[model samples]
Target: MAVLHPRVAPRRSTTRATTWWGKAWVRAVEEAAFSESDLVTARTLARGGHVGQITTRPGGFFASVEDQHGLWTVDGAIPELDETGTETVVEAVAAEAGRIAALLGGDLPHDLVEHTDEAGVELLPFGSELAATCTCEAWAEPCVHALAVLQQLAWLIEADPMVLLQLRGLAREDLLGRLHARRESPVSDDERDLDAAVEAALYAARLLDDPLS
Candidate 1:
């Protein structure tokens, strides 16, 4: 079973909320909660970058984000496979997500800018078919609303890394296909015999433990 960490609530602030971005973030969160397929997508897109398209109008900013089956946050960071070499995928995605969070929090290192196609830009995969892009334009990298969405995503990611993988175009089916192909490949007779023997031994062991044995 997976253990979930308890979330620490944010400290309340009493200062007058007058910043334009701040207000926009608040509105974005509220609208996202009602409109998003899930909390993850709502939060990530709310953080604000280029994960999708953002259209600004006289009324306000309208964002059109790709929906990855409604999963969000760090969960979006998880890949679908758990085979060897897949850890690299998870780490890369996490590193990217972390960079985005750091930029948003004003803690990003200057040297890291080169990794991104554009300076201070962060792109996060939402799922196998979707992603969220964050451009560090404001003092708050993603702004407050975007940060709020990210906070939620972090929690989800910590819980399950698969969400990130699916966002990066690698799904469970992809992993299984790779595994099946590897197993079916031609091999020496000795190697094949050894493999068969191992399977037979495992089956015999299971039979021994069975109540019907």
Candidate 2:
């Protein structure tokens, strides 16, 4: 799997999301907020171009961030979907072949976003499900540095929607392989054969544990 190296441009005064998926992802991170101060700090840090050495894994994203608050002591992590959750995601994708094609093409189709929501498949974190954690001194999350890293993530996904899938729980190739299996034998019924769907997705989901995948 290729590691997505985002061209974190400088002078990001504020976060922007033009695409539906990008908007949803940014909204989720903002929604997990405790105060506006965090957002402001994150924006400031991002503009100053302090976040760096960013890396993504199946389970989450991690990076080295810097700011006045922490000198040579900055790190953050954004966890993604879990194994059990991946099965549901696979099943949902199985029922929607067009969605797979769109993802394979690097487009996060609006219809697929709706389907994922309808099926309760969290390709990104929502509300209190999780928040970006950091090694900074801040007691709250989406801490300035962490938020900066997340903001960069927004840019990354905007460029390539498949990165969202990578964050969720599977690498593009592995997820594609599983999806190919689904195409060969479409899921008969999501509810009745949920077990089978999960089983089919198990191998790919397990690989999600691989760091920097």
Clashes per candidate (backbone, < 3 Å): 26, 0
Off-target runs (Cα >4 Å) in candidate 2 are 1-4, 12-14, 69-84, 94-97, 183-213
Q: In terms of lDDT, which candidate is strongest? A: 2
Q: Which digits, one per residue and each the tens of the lDDT, describe model 1 over residues 1-213?
A: 122323423323332224332333244334434234344444444343323332221111223233334422222122223333354432332333243233223332333423432422332322222212333232422333343444343333333333223333444334233323334543666435434443443455468679586
How high is each candidate's TM-score? Answer: 0.28, 0.72
Name the lDDT of candidate 2: 0.66
Clashes counted in candidate 2 amount to 0
Query: Which ten residues in a row are the worst by lDDT in model 1?
Result: 53-62
lDDT of 1: 0.34
51: Cα error in model 1, Å: 17
Model 2: how far residue 161 lies from native, Å = 2.1
* lDDT tens digits by residue: candidate 2, 52-104: 85677665677778766564333434456667667677666666545555565
Instruction: Please tell me which predicted candidate would have the highest TM-score against the true structure.
Output: 2
**Residue 37: error of model 1 in Å?**
27
